[model samples]
Target: EKKDKKDKKEKKRSREENGAAPKCADEKPAKETRVEGAQAAGDVAARKAFLKEHRMTMEGNGVETFFPCYTFAEAKFPAQANEAIQNYAKPTPIQAVSWPVIRAGRDIIGVAETGSGKTMGFALPSLPHILGAKQKLPKVVVLAPTRELAMQTSVEYERLKVNQVCLYGGAPKGDQIKALRTNPDVVIATPGRLIDLCDSGLCDLSQVSYAVLDEADRMLDTGFEEPVRKILGMVNKKRQMLMFTATWPDSVERLASSFLRDPIKLTVGSTELTANVRVKQTVEMIQQYDKDKRLLALLKEYKVGDNSRVIIFVLYKKDAPKVEGLLKGRGYTVGALHGDSSQAMREATIAQFRKGEIPIMVATDVAARGLDIDDIEHVINYSMPLTIEDYIHRIGRTARAGKTGTAHSFFMHPADKNLGWHTAKVLRDAGQPVPPELEKYGPPAVKQVEKTCNISEMAPAPKITFDDSDSD
Candidate 1:
């Protein structure tokens, strides 16, 4: 008995030196563990109180486990955290609240406007979960709605030295299959291609412990809900799930209930279709034919510079190339991105835009949701989006990382009148001026003019006889 006790003591000391969990028999006493847990609870309470004092509203069960961090220095792995902070300066509001919740190993639903640093909000917390794990299978799977977003998410993981594979359509699958053979630690992919890989036995999700649904709303909008649901079902049910979106529609709410287990919901601001407050919004009422000229004038005001990078969004895919040509002809370096653009072209365009080789990018809604580029000073809506949600996302391309930006929207009368009411409401909520034509469509006003004239008010005219003179 004496010899066994001595051996156990030495074993516990060795494990401590090696940074391993202590053996059950040598673990701390239950009462001591409980006391430490109580202290942690108290610390979280204090942090929540601080958030409340700052007017950051958060609500849900088990939210006390989440504590906001003012800087990356407060992170669990400060070295890794500092890498991101060095680029972003500090955490945004969403990142500040989300990091702790995700780090606490609880499911979370994060809703914030575009350009709020949501990518890092989920990425930072996932690092610790995946870093030391065996690379036989993916431990983290991030599903994005578009290829651009998936690629961007993968880049975030790469910056941290985390091994990752991005799988999406439009690109050749042979490379992706070869990447999967290496058994990466993370898989960033679109829903359709992920499902195809899983079905073909080229990938596995049974061991996936962390799953993130980025741009959840857009996923549903693009008819990816079925594939997303299927992928979720294949993953470990005991895993931690994180759902992030710019807007929370009924579809996304349903998705959360089905996949997430007792999620804590966090919203950075009012739960409505709203753009970042830092974006100065302007709505110009112009004729349809004059939109190109108006866009030229706006672009002239914001030339290529360190702080003058811009994204111009068109409503249709066909318009993207046309706009690109028009801008290039006007002596502006520009690139186009849309659904029809080949994967190689899209990648080259995005790379050029990121490096400021092309200071302006003309794109469709494909670039609206998850393309994260820094220092975008302006977002020009050459054509109004079909929905107010899309409009908010389009303008969100600017005003990112707490930096101020400008959004200029061309609202052609008659053509864009259908969206006038919703557009006016969004502008009003943001405290921006509503064009007179759009203001007429606002609440408490008539959206359409009723051209009515009563026949009873018409005056009678006397009949006159004319002489037949020059007919012959």
Candidate 2:
């Protein structure tokens, strides 16, 4: 009887294999879960677990991460990450969009206003790529427009445990060359000095697979087109490319077309420039002579003790020293930073500001961009910036790290009458009501006046300036 049962079971299995259900058996086959891999046992599982937990915190979709990626902390990155990197939050709007694209080894052209965390927008992803690649270590090159930008990038890049160096002018060339000797994984440089290093055969950029042109619009404005082109030609053609800028102009577009291949256009300006919502915008109108007094009054109201922070911006380098001197004399503990100051002084002043020893900084437009000082509670624009772009950068110092901030601008007598239309347009874009009080001093060239020039269907008409082309 047992022999007969065995024969019957074998016949049933054959039938199931032949596209039919077993005649007697009613259960399905059981499978075992394999939690190991070819390289590292359980690596895939651990990675999935880590990413599942971290992805949400890092990508809070603006609701969670309100400020820039001042710190890589919110990402809950691996504990092996350097400690200095843990104090700041996750990525900004532009950084979040660009990080994945860069990690995928794709080209990207990011349009974010200055002080919008554009530096780390590409740096974070590229750092890991260069550090983690199992293949030959590839170099990542970042080209910034000015010395200050190079230093800013250096500060963030150094926060990572990876090997990196900054090579730019204004600092001693010997020290820069010494840093380069380490065979760094990343290089932050200016277009001019980078070209010089390439010519000297001191920097081997042929193996550089990731190339970034930070502040692309500024590069074009400063006439670094030829130098930038030469640097781009040296890096690997099969590598990734990224360009970030505050404003997207024809020059930036042309450079993007030349450098990046089918680049992804990641922009926060869904409708217009006003979408740079990380900054707080305000206008304080007063008489020209009362500008100084009103600024003092605003400072008094803002109240920066040893804990709070302030960054005051002046239009000209001449005004930087003047304002700083006066503020210091008034027991405000202020310092002046401008292009005229030596690199050492600039760095020292920045250090003092960072240490909170100097609570207030009076700077010019040259100090406007590429600065990453954080937790600034107040941005007092003593005078309105000549360029709306400068205004954006100045105010961006505040409202960081999920913190509310104040940006006070003086639209004193001269500015209300003299400031350009674009400045007012920026205000309108911010959703802030630009009261007629801002235009208290006077109107532009032409004004409307009622006249009895029987025209259309009325007996009176207001004369308006109209070119033939302006007519619809």
Candidate 3:
């Protein structure tokens, strides 16, 4: 009896040293006491400090138990998935904190900045989740907002050696249908095309147990909310839902409440809408007619032809081709990307841009979200977008992956003033100088209500400027 007792104690010690929980009935009380003590003191303080240092905010139940991984080994991902990420020494803040929560089969709403490694954060966990399923017939579904994002997502997942297919509207449906028949383990798709396939009996989502809505805010902004809702309704009711977005809005909150069950919300940075601070933003107030000339001047200053890649964002499809022609006529090689471009042309242009064959591309908001090209030195807003949200996404094309870049905008008042009001505040928040002309369009002051008023009879709007230091 003495020898048996000693052996049991040794086994318990070995398990504890390996970071496993004690299985012996007699050892449970001691282990519980130690964990409770740590949780009440050192553990809580250390977790709080770590989250503060990384600018992370976590909410909801089960978040206090969340532990972050610094190195790839600490994450303890499956051997197959680990092999694909061997080149990455450490996970990003989003990726680091998400592994444990997601692997535990908890639904999550992740809000992080763009280029923050959100794709890998969710993808790594899905690999093991899908592998554990009994039969793989589209066990995982990732719905991206754009075709480029969907294709890029598929590329990332394929690296894990998982059989996957990408579905989008701009491409040929025949090929997608053929691939769908093969019973892929994962389906990376856009909402429109995926809905079309489901309606026609080409795709079956009934067996899908995992669904990811990548860039959920953008998806809703682009009029895909109804289709996304329909797609989610088609999936299995007992599914795990992962919703990730760069910004969190009321619309997303409503959607989350409807679908996710007790999801843990993880935010890596501030939830307020703000541009990437790494991009130096400059608003050049000019007449609408002077924009064409000013664009050329700015390009020359940036040395675009000397191996500098720049993206010029326009507000309309009609302007994309015209801007492309203007650049080509000026002895510069350029490509145009807009809603009207065929899928083949869009892919070809992106391929050329990636290979350095075309150093400049004039594009619309369609290109703003998901072009994976690196080293984009500058982003020029030839025509300011209608909303400040769009402006943030356009400028986000630059200043990626720890590299500093610049965004220059040709701001025309009266036409762009509505958006300029919020834009100025965004600039001030980033420590960038807000042009005085654009600053004058701030919100109006409250005045006595008039029974009847003419357009010219109203009082001039109050001039406002945001000073972060003065804001308490």
Candidate 4:
């Protein structure tokens, strides 16, 4: 009995030293007491200092348990950490705060501005969890709102040497199915195609350990709320959830309550609708007919060098082709991207644009959310978007990675008057100059009404007498 007791104690001590919980019933209480005492004293101070240093706002239960990092070396994945240090040089604000929370195995709702390195914020932390997992089904599933974004995410995963299969609607299903047969570590997909594949038994989420909803607000806006819910239901219940959005609306909060289990809300900046301060926004009040001329002029002014890139955003997908054609006719090398473009054509266009072979791209809102190309010089809003949220995303195409860029918007009077209030608010928030005409349409301005006197109550006969005499 003495030898058995000594062996048990030695086993418990070994487990404790290895960072594992003590399994012996007698040693468990002491282990818990020590852990609680240490946590009560050190954890709070460390978390407070980290939050203040990073200028981050965190709200949720047990948020103090996670640590923040100044460099990727302190993160979980050393390989990805090395890659980030060597390639990207340093972590962005979002990455610096989010990587630690995510790596600590906590569900997080990350709210950051566009072009704030949100992809790497979620991607790097996710790698260490799913990289070496052995399972027939994918361990990590990243849902994007658009095919382009899904493909872009897949590229990021590949860069980290994390084998991933992209399943989006525009691509060929046979290729995706073949890729899935190999059992990739990560599955980057859009909601519709992912749902279709899961229903058809080509893809399975039963073994998914990590689920990410990238651009969560945009997903809700694009009518993916139901599909997202359905996909979430199909995944394993005991999975880690990460949601990222540029802006947080009530809908996102509702989705979080429904799907997430006590998630930590990490907002890097103001949650209100605002554009990046790095973007220099200008509004040109012009007639609808003169938009073409203004676009050409702005292009010449902005797109000066061979490496300079410009993206012109239009409201409708049909307008993308027309704008591309018009620019081509004007001796500009340009390409168009919209939902209607074939997958091959869209990929080719983006590749050429990225390589600087085609310096201009005409696109709809499909390219607004998750298209991350560095060094884009200008974003031209040839036409105003339907919503202020979309307008913020449209201009966000440029001014990425700490580089200053310009956004030129052509606003038509009376037609764009309804958007005037919201547009002016965003402009003022970004510290840009709001046009005087547009400001008139903003709030705090009351219209003057002409008050009429009651003609029946007035002495009208005296005034009519001269007219009657002239008529007679």
What TM-score, computed on C-alpha atoms, does each candidate reach?
0.82, 0.72, 0.84, 0.83
lDDT of 4 by residue, 105-172 (tens): 77888887778888888888777667567676788999999888898888888778877899989777
**Whole-structure CA lDDT of model 4:** 0.79
lDDT of 2 by residue, 240-269 (tens): 887887776543465456665645555555
The 10-residue segment of model 2 with minimum total lDDT is 56-65
* lDDT tens per residue, model 3, 44-136: 556556677667777766566666666687677777886678787678878877777787778888887667778888898897767888775
Q: Clashing residue pairs in candidate 3, if any? A: none
Error of 3 at 281 (Å): 1.2
lDDT of 1 by residue, 1-472 (tens): 9999999899889989999877795566555322111234457555545554433555555554456676666656536656665766667777777777777677888888887778888887887768767658889999999899999998888777777899999889999999999888889999999999999999999989999999987876648878988999999888999989988865457545767666667776666676677889999988878988888888877766554799999999999989999988978888999989889999999999988898999999889875898678899999998878889889988887678999999888778777898888888888888888887874445456343331111223221111233131
Once fitted onto the true fold, the runs of candidate 2 whose alpha carbons sit more than 4 angstroms away are: 1-92, 113-116, 132-138, 275-278, 412-419, 437-472
> What do the candidate models score in CA lDDT, each in turn?
0.79, 0.67, 0.81, 0.79
Deviation in angstroms for 264 in model 2? 0.6
- Kindly report which residue pairs in candidate 4 clash with one another: none
Q: Would you give me the overall lDDT of model 1?
A: 0.79
> Highest TM-score among the candidates is held by which one?
3
As for lDDT, the candidate ahead, 3 or 4, is 3
